[model samples]
Target: MRLNYPFFFIFFLFFINSTYSYSADCEKPIMPSDAEWNSWIQDIKEEAYTEGISKKTINQELDLITPQKKIILRDRCQPESQITFDEYLYYRVDKSRIMSGKNMMKKYKNELELVANHFNIQPRFIVAVLGLESFYGKNQGKIKTMEAVGTLAYDRRRSNFYKKQLFAALKIIDMNLVESKSLIGSWGGAIGAVQMIPTTYLESGYDFDGDDKIDIWNNYLDIFASVANYLTSIDKNPWSSDSTWGREVIPPNNIKDIYDSLKQIDPKGCGAVKRRSVPKKLSEWKKLGFKKINGDPLPIRDDLEARLVAPDGIDGSKFYLVYPNYKNILYYNCSSYYALSIGILSDEIIK
Candidate 1:
């Protein structure tokens, strides 16, 4: 065959330009010096004051903090671990985690049931989210919340997001919702057993036990209720008590071809949702050769609709027929891997 040198050269140029663009986006900028950080903090305080945060709260929380450059570095280098869905699931839904989840479910049975009744959500799922986020409240985070959010707010990328989080953290302090000294959490500023950010805590955190505090850190009642509240309050499609998130399945040998034809025509919601096949009745999926993992036929019903998701794509080892409730889990954490882990863990917790 004759060599297409010109075509290869053009492809090389395109590849080089794409790589450079990606590198440019990921490149880290210089960390701010102490003087620069102090000045930035002053500006932040002024903004917080305008947002109605108390002056005392601003000075007390914002004054003594130093920039956490390590957080910014971690944020910039947030690794997208290159692994298959099975490998991801292996670590997230292991034997120990499942056992711990079961134990937590039993230990907090009354509280979990209360939240379940109040929010119309399953108790197992609430436990699964808590277990996954903080390992049953063992590792919520060690970083001081103000310092972490403040440092990230000062950084360039995602400045607005972290800034909002910082103000919310300050507001939480101002309201005396949580003690300032106890306000420590993840490097990214998510707090408490359920690992909610400040804004979410403010909006959804509940005083379920009626101590007049939404103490997600040490209060399993608040934590469980908050998770249930977040799920039930998701706009449009909320969690359905009658259905589970999704189930594992075996797709047809021609799944790729089937998916190409049946994939969502109008991409909606997040990129994850867009990647899934359009909603087909369980009967329809059964007709198309999809079956439960145990080789049982899908329910022979047209009333129920489900979307097909091969998170690792058609060639991967697993596939799911997810329900609308699955999208509610996505609202909790968008990734298929994260949502799937929550679902599988929840299933195992009750088993």
Candidate 2:
């Protein structure tokens, strides 16, 4: 029943079909006419009513909704979609972010430990995710959640997905989880310090601080606990407290051949999971010439399996051998670039 989905799916889902840009020569895209927009709003209201949202809430919240051009444009031109893996990592996991993450770790040492102990997630990782998502609560976006999600739901690209998110946002308001006036978040409708989409918040958010409200926006305790809880929400590969996310690996000279031979298809999960190589035991990978980034031998563990992920490709200078815990992080954001940044940041901040 949890509707929380990998946020990266939205980026990939939209980018899969077309790439939009803001160049001067680029033709301006068409917007829906008022009449068209109104009809869609009417249909959405009926659907919301059918979905069991109170008539009062629907009438108050959806009456004046309109498609937002800014939200549509923001969705179309995310920087991660266009950048190289190195470039993306460089910006996402920079020195400033690392230092801030460390400070946050110290500042919330006690609270983080409690959340970590309760949820069995690494404290540094919780810090890393929040740091990346909203700069440790300093910048959790200001766009009105209803308006942003409504716009996305109306847009042709990823309409079904956003429609679900829009309704989830409404449900939150109807449940009195967060008031309509204060329901603000990212252009993509991701709320709070951890940048959870409405569906994710509804499903995984917790009132850890016991304030009677799950305030991921301002409460650090709730934010930390919510993140830890969400990370461990994956049932098949629940986070392993005994293991770390993954490490950078030095691949064999014939990594391309090795990659082709070892690659296996995943029919389930998002497109990101499908792009990674099949999981192989650490021992098997070691025998095939995979080593620690520092040229050390991989841990002698035949029991553990890891998947080789080269976001840039075999030609890229860096490669990672990701463990199951990495997939847990992927539940938050499906992209390897995003997950790797969290992994590396988690290590750096703790050091």
Candidate 3:
């Protein structure tokens, strides 16, 4: 999801791609020479074989790999990278998507409840992620997984990170989890209904149906369970089913300076938005005049800590007091806009 392009270059490419279109002949604008590309593949093959990938897989999958110009272009032109929070929410959490998610939850109620109970994750959260990632498997992407990962591995900007993913993808093929030819995903190598990267799939995938294979692409049970397992996985920040992601609130005018002074720049890869103040007990925020948008008192739980986030700046119409569960959603996708959309969409589905 995160590629290490220089920040300025990313904005420059976005600007150029938005302003103009390349002709078909100019589509592949940049590529290494054949000799150079072949040598890189040879090196990858050697490393793959030494790591225990079968010779057949190495020869069949790696030999035919070529730079996927389309993937590089897609990576550089992500609309979500440039859109406003309101625009992002409108596009991703529309009425149609909410309706589809509701139907999906109703149709799969028994299975969803089973997985939710087993994993202690909310069913709505799982369904929301499914809807956001692939429209409930209706658009699981069309690019070949190996080809996409291989192309990024050779692109040089984030080669080392993507090379590791390429290896993980080959191991998936070697284990017969999915055939090399049938393995498909997004331009960045995220796969299946949940759009997990190869490393995430290997780490948290579950065979919920007990068929002995984790088929996130085709099996609804496995897909749901795998998603739940991932959020609850030990390697991730812990998710608390006891808390909601966040609540909309109104801050008192007298507290403006305190809130403004608390703002901080988000770490790289977190998102472009400014982060909120460091967390404090919910009780403390209540004493400072934060209240629910409905004018109710803030929750009186002494054990809970939260941060105030106003995505469009302090004067923005939307303001939220977010909890740890909100941060957990960020692990699934780093963007605050992305996490907020998921939370709002999940709430709509539950309603």
Candidate 4:
């Protein structure tokens, strides 16, 4: 799976709770006295030492230990179910974000290009991810990652995932990629301008700026490029600049025929991710009575393997013919609806 990319904290929890022992129910709230905090801090330091974390790192992280509501609110505020696409597109993808991205593009053009060229991905795509993730760092999460991860680790609903993230965060400290004291980020552990979690920092982040540290928080170049490289590592073809990330289309009434034809083929990652290998193109979709939202023929790409995706259920208002690259965007965030927002927003930004 893509590791809970939707809210980002869940994936963060996956890594955050690996080694922590639950103390109490976080919501009921037992304000650990200064002495108690100190005791727990020492215990945490011992755990870190056992895990090979340095004394310096443990001390640095322990220095900042006051609790805040921001982290708890993030988990509690997660939508009970997926918000409808209309709501997501209307609220999440706004003109302000697109304008901000354009402004940032102009400001950081040279740096973004260099990073994209080095990473073999598009600068716009990287920019889109930044905009979506944190509005280009406007709201880079505020919770101390160690604390947030620790809280979730103790929550038990996703104890295992949070524990792993906690372990990974410790590893990050040990690696010296980021300092343990530098716990500035999303309500989750996503740090820096691009807002990568510690685990993601370990996996996809790099010091493109040659600053001797992969410091994405302070450096725009490192943050921008690291986000691009992360996407490329997962699937390079999705980074191609030429393609649109699927479109809202109108499909025929009898869409089941196409779905049935594709189901006979047992596929691994693609279908599970909603990428059905429909061996057709614009021409076939048109032939099957598909029409563009604007009531015109879709521009043809005969050779490409296209999938008929109704992001809403079959009876929902819109139909989409998603390409494999669009599926790759879904890899960026697992929800079909989330992917749809990014795809549509990207097209708007580029256009």
For model 4, what is the C-alpha lDDT against the true structure? 0.67
Q: Which ten residues in a row have the lowest lDDT in candidate 2?
A: 1-10
lDDT of 2 by residue, 319-347 (tens): 99999999888888887788888899999
Please provide TM-scores, in order, for all candidate models, with all chains considered together: 0.90, 0.88, 0.87, 0.79
The per-model lDDT (C-alpha) reads 0.81, 0.82, 0.79, 0.67
Weakest 10 consecutive residues of candidate 4 by summed lDDT? 17-26
lDDT of 3 by residue, 21-88 (tens): 43343334487899999999999999988888898988888987899777776665443344456765
**Candidates 1 and 4 compared by TM-score, better number:** 1
Expressed as tens digits, the lDDT of each residue in 38-70 for candidate 4 is 775566667767877677766766566554455
| lDDT over C-alpha atoms for residue 291 of model 2 | 93
**Candidate 1 lDDT, tens digit per residue, 65-153?**
99876777656644332467886677678899999999998888888898899999999989998777778899777789899889889
Return the TM-score for candidate 4, rounded to 2 decimals.
Answer: 0.79
TM-score of 2: 0.88
| Model 4: residues with Cα > 4 Å off, grouped in runs | 1-51, 59-82, 235-238, 256-272, 275-282
Model 1 Cα displacement at 159 (Å)? Answer: 0.7
Model 3: number of clashes? Answer: 0
What lDDT would candidate 2 get against the real structure? 0.82
